[model samples]
Target: MGDPVTDPAPDGIDEGRRLIRLGGDKGLSLADRLAERFHRLTWRTPLHTLRLKGRYPLKLIAVPEDPILGDIARGTMLLEGVLSFRGEARDIETLDLSKPHPKPFAEYLQSFAWLRDLSTVATRARGAPIAEYLMGLWLTAHADTQGGIAWRPDMWGRRILAWTAHAPLILSSSDQIYRSKVLNALAKGALHLDRTADKAPAGAPRIAAWCGVVAAGLLIPGGEPRQAFGEAGLLRALGTGLFDDGGSVSRSPAMLLDSIQLLTLLQESYAARSAELPETVAVTLTRMVAALLGVAHADRGLSSWQGGGPASETQVAAVIEASGVRTRPLRQARDWGYQRLAAGTAVLIVDAAPPPIARL
Candidate 1:
C-alpha cells in the first residue's frame, strides 16, 4: 500500500497553515520532528559494554547484552535531564515555531537520544498498535516546564485514558506488551509518589491537583483505590487552587490556558463515569473560563503575552467545552482554543470544511 491517509481536511488544513503563520514555521516543524524523532530513537539497543579502569592496565570488557541494565542506565540519564527543565523558564505554549524555547522542543533537546530511539521503534512497528502506544509514551514521557510530574507524567496518565478511551484506535492484540508498559508506567506514576521527587510549585496548587486527575484515571483502570486519594486531593486543590476570579495562581496566560485544560480533562474523565464533580470545582472551572475568555485575543488564541507557553485553538476549544461554561469570542485570541467559536468563527468551516488535507 501507498502512504496512509494522514492528511487533515480543509478546515483543519487552513487552521494548520494559519497555525504555522501565527505560531511560526520553526515551531511547527519542531513538533513534527519531535514526534518523528522520538519514534526513531527508541526502537533498538546496542550490545552491553563494561568499562574498567585501574592501576592495572585493563581494557573494556564485553558482556552479555542485558536489556534491563541498559534500560536503567539510559533511563537514569533520561529522567535527570528531562526532570531538570521542570523548574526552568519553560512552559508548554511555545513548544512550536514561535517561542525561542518550547517545552516540546526542550523534550527534543533533553532526550534527543531517547526520542531518536523511539522514532525508530515506531517506524519498525509502522501503523501497528506499538506505534501509537510508543508515540503516546513519547509525548507523555516528555518533560514540559511543569517538570517531573506535570505534563510528562500527566501525559502518561492522559494517554493511558486516551488508549482506554479510544482503545480500538490505539491498542490491539499485536501490541500487548506495548499496552502493558504504558499502563504500568501510568499506574506507577499515579499511585507511587516515591518513584520521582519532583514537587509542586509554590504558587500553583493545581500541579498537585492535576496529579489527582491522572490518578483518577489510573485508579479506574487498575481497579485500585491508592491512586484515588491523590486524585480526590488534587480535585480539592483545583477547586480551591484556582483563583476566585478563575485565573491560575501563576497568572501567566500560558499557565491559565494549561490549567483550564487540566481541569476540563479531570471533569470530563469523571463525567464520563457519571461521577459528580464537587460544586466548588465546577464553579472554579466556570470562573476560569470567564477569566481566560476575558483575556483572549481576536484570533481565538492568547496574545503570547507574559511569557506564555504555547496555546493553540484546539486546546482552547477542548477546555471551553469541557468547562461547561458559557462564552463569547474575541477576534484577538482566535487561536487560543475555544475563543474562535466564542467569536462566532465556524470551526467546522475552518476546521472541518477543508478538503485535500495538509500533513505536517
Candidate 2:
C-alpha cells in the first residue's frame, strides 16, 4: 500500500536491477527489477538454467506466470535487514555443553544446519545471507543445549544436517573453538543415528552414508586421526551410496552435478591443507567423473536427466579444472554423450557414450 522500501537504497536497488538484467540477458525475461530481486534472493540461479541435464519436464513444475522470484527477493531482504549492523545483537548465552537441548530449540538448530547447505547454492538470494546468520545463531545458541544438534525426522532436514558435516571440516579449520563444537555435534548426530537405526525410514541408508562422509571429512582435519571405524564407514558409504551407473544415486541431474561440485570442494579442501585424500576415494571419484562424461550431452553441458541441473557449461569446466585430471574429449564419430570441438567452439555436447569403462 505504501512506497516500497526498495524504491530507495540507491546501491541495493541498482545492484538488484543489475543482477536481474544479467538473468534477463541469459533469457529468463524477468518482467522488472522487483521480479529480478525475487529470483536472485530465492532461486539463486535461474530455474530454467537449473533444468539443464535434468529429466523432469519443467512445464509441470512451473508456477503460474508470477514465478518464484518474489520468494527469493523476500528472503534476501530478511538477510540485508539482519546483517545491516555488526554485533548489535547480544551474544548468545553459554549453554551446558554436557546436556541435551530442549526439543524445540534442538529442532531449530537442526534447521539452521540445513539452512547452511541451502545458502551455499542460494548465493544471490537475500534469504541466502539471512539463512547463514540464522544457522550461525542456532549453532551458537544450541551447542551447549541439552542434545547438541541431531538429525531431524524429515528428509529435507536430514539432508541439510548431513551436508553441514563438510563445512566445519573445510571452513572452520582456523577456528578451533568452532571446530570443536562441530566435532561434538557430529558425534552426537552419529550417536543418535546409531540409537535409532530401527526407527529410521527405508531410505535412511543414504543419511548413514553421509554421516560416514562427515566423519571422514572431520578425520582429515584432526591430524588424520586414526578413527578406523569412521574412516571405514565413510569409504564404504561413498563407494556404495553416492554413485549409480548413470552417475549419482539421486537421479536428479542437478543433484549429480551438485555432488560433483561438492566433491571438488572436498578435494580442494584437502589439497589446500596439504592432506592426502585416500587412494580408494580418488579412484571412485575418477570413475564418477568418467560416468558423468559418459552421460554429458554433446555441448559439454549435461542434458536434463531427471529433475533440474545447471545450464552453464562453466560449472562442469570448473569441476574438471579442479580435478587436475585430463578428461578425454567426446568423439565426434560416436555421437553418444560426446562433445565435438570445431575451430571456434571450445566444447559442444552430443549424445555419445564413451568407449567401454576403463579400470581406474
Model 2 residue-pair collision total: 40
Model 2, residue 185: what's the lDDT? 51
Model 1 ranges off by over 4 Å: 1-103, 106-130, 133-167, 193-198, 202-224, 239-241, 309-315, 327-360
Backbone clash count for every predicted candidate, in the order shown:
58, 40
Worst 10 residues of 1 by lDDT: 60-69
Q: Whole-model lDDT, candidate 1?
A: 0.40
lDDT of 2 by residue, 113-170 (tens): 3343234434433333344344455456553332223433232224323334324322
TM-score of each: 0.47, 0.44
1-360: candidate 1 lDDT, tens digit per residue: 743322111121234443212222232356756864453332222210011111221111111110111123333333332211334432222223223455553543332223322222233234233335334544454411223323343344333333333333334446566565444443443443312112233223334335444434433443336344555556555544444445454445677766665555455455555564557666666656765765665445665644566566555665575556664322222233222334344332112111111221
RMSD of each: 18.4, 20.7
* Candidate 2 CA-lDDT value: 0.39
For each candidate, what is the lDDT?
0.40, 0.39
